[model samples]
Target: MTRTWTIAGSLSVEPATQRTDLLAEPVAKALAALENHREEAGVAPIDPELADTAAFCEAYGSPLAASANCVVVSGKRAGEVRYAAAMVLATTRADVNNVIKRRLDVRKASFAPMAEAVELTGMEYGGITPVGLPEGWPILVDKAVAEAPELVVGSGIRGSKLLVSGALLASLPGAEVVEDLGKV
Candidate 1:
């Protein structure tokens, strides 16, 4: 079956490989590295003002269920810090306090500061995506997100969004499918 993405909204979808300009540097570099996987991705432009999940969905006509939110979280232990990206559906929240904390094997875990996350990921504050995260950072994907056919996620920039499959996300480097990662 030929795979087609959901872009029924006002956004114009284009092959991510050809629209590298729409992606952040890190995201573009990451996608370029994935020769086979890049073909499975697409990009769409959006107003930066509507980068937020709720606003983007409402303005672009994408449903919350089909959108995935990527959040950066960090934990400290023994003078060391561990950072991970959690990908969950917009309809749910990442179980940061419990599931994520346990998954990272850290005693305490919480959202990473905006400044820190932006500096580290090299992506805009509200446009961080799992595709091009810093090496060594684990990507924890919610089970529901992993099973999704297509999902609207950040393009590492506020001006655009990435269209990708759950399997592609789950196959990203250091990605792990976590059950109950998202709590409704």
Candidate 2:
């Protein structure tokens, strides 16, 4: 029997393992690497044009509070560059300037340029997720997001979204649950 996902959105979800074509290459590889944990994630197709958080939630019947957004940030310290992924709820914004800057221990930190982020992650713009990032990159999951029952997040492609439990997200490689990582 096929399992039904208890996700909040009106999206039609299928096990990500069974719909590899809807996922970006890096996302498929990462999910495959998860092995036993892969079953906990599900994917749903969407109109690529509605990839943005607000538009997606409004059009797909997913509550904004049940969606998570991932952003890539870069900070330069001395001569080396440090990069990290910040995952926060759609209802809140990542504290990039204050929290992430300090966490990266750089003089300053800012969102990575769109071109650079897409190139580095091998994912489309606006569809970047914490999964499949560079092996050593830190993934900061906001406390609120980490506590959610389930969340809709980018699937590395604008054509689909992933439905996953917060615990699953918090357990991804290099994920760290940080308090107050997001701000209203």
Candidate 3:
């Protein structure tokens, strides 16, 4: 089935009904990189409000538990790169030291501040996803989250997102399945 969605306009509109591209701008860049790196995964666009975990649930008529949210982590002591992308379920949080940080080879790691994350991702603070990162950062998904029916991820642009199966997402772009990411 070819999936499609309509964006619920930003917080300032009245009974806002607007639409934009499915794959948000930032997500588009990430897909291009993955494609360039030879990732075979494809991203589907959806209404921008669906970009949020809860909004995604309501718009797609799916449980929020099934949505996949991607967070861009900055200041990862993971190598000298200092930045990374951490993809996990709304039900969980990325483990910093014991797993993620260690894996990234960073001595210290923290979620990038909202402003920094926004500037780097080129998307709003709550709208970052792994689909279109600036490159170099790795995408780590919780193994459990990897099993949901469909997940909502940023579309690279603030105006859209991709709704996909956790399995398909993992298969696409070869997302890594990691254990120990904390369940929240």
How do all models score by TM-score? 0.96, 0.96, 0.69
lDDT of 2 at 109: 96
Supply candidate 2's per-residue lDDT for 140. Answer: 97
Scored by lDDT, model 3 comes in at: 0.58
Error of 2 at 163 (Å): 0.5
Query: Could you give candidate 3's per-residue lDDT for residues 67-132 as a string of tens digits?
Result: 567766655432455776777877777786567677667777777788887787677766676665
Compute the lDDT for candidate 1: 0.92
Candidate with the larger lDDT of 1 and 2: 1
Clashes of 3: 15
- Residue 12, model 1, lDDT: 83
Clash totals, every prediction: 0, 0, 15
Number of the top lDDT candidate: 1
What lDDT does candidate 2 reach at residue 163? 88
Off by over 4 Å in 2: 1-3
Model 1 Cα lDDT, one tens digit per residue, 1-184 = 2346664377788889889999999999999898556788989999999999999999989888999999999998887999999999999999999999998889999999999999999999899999999999999999999999889999999999999989989989999999999999
Note the Cα lDDT for every prediction shown: 0.92, 0.90, 0.58
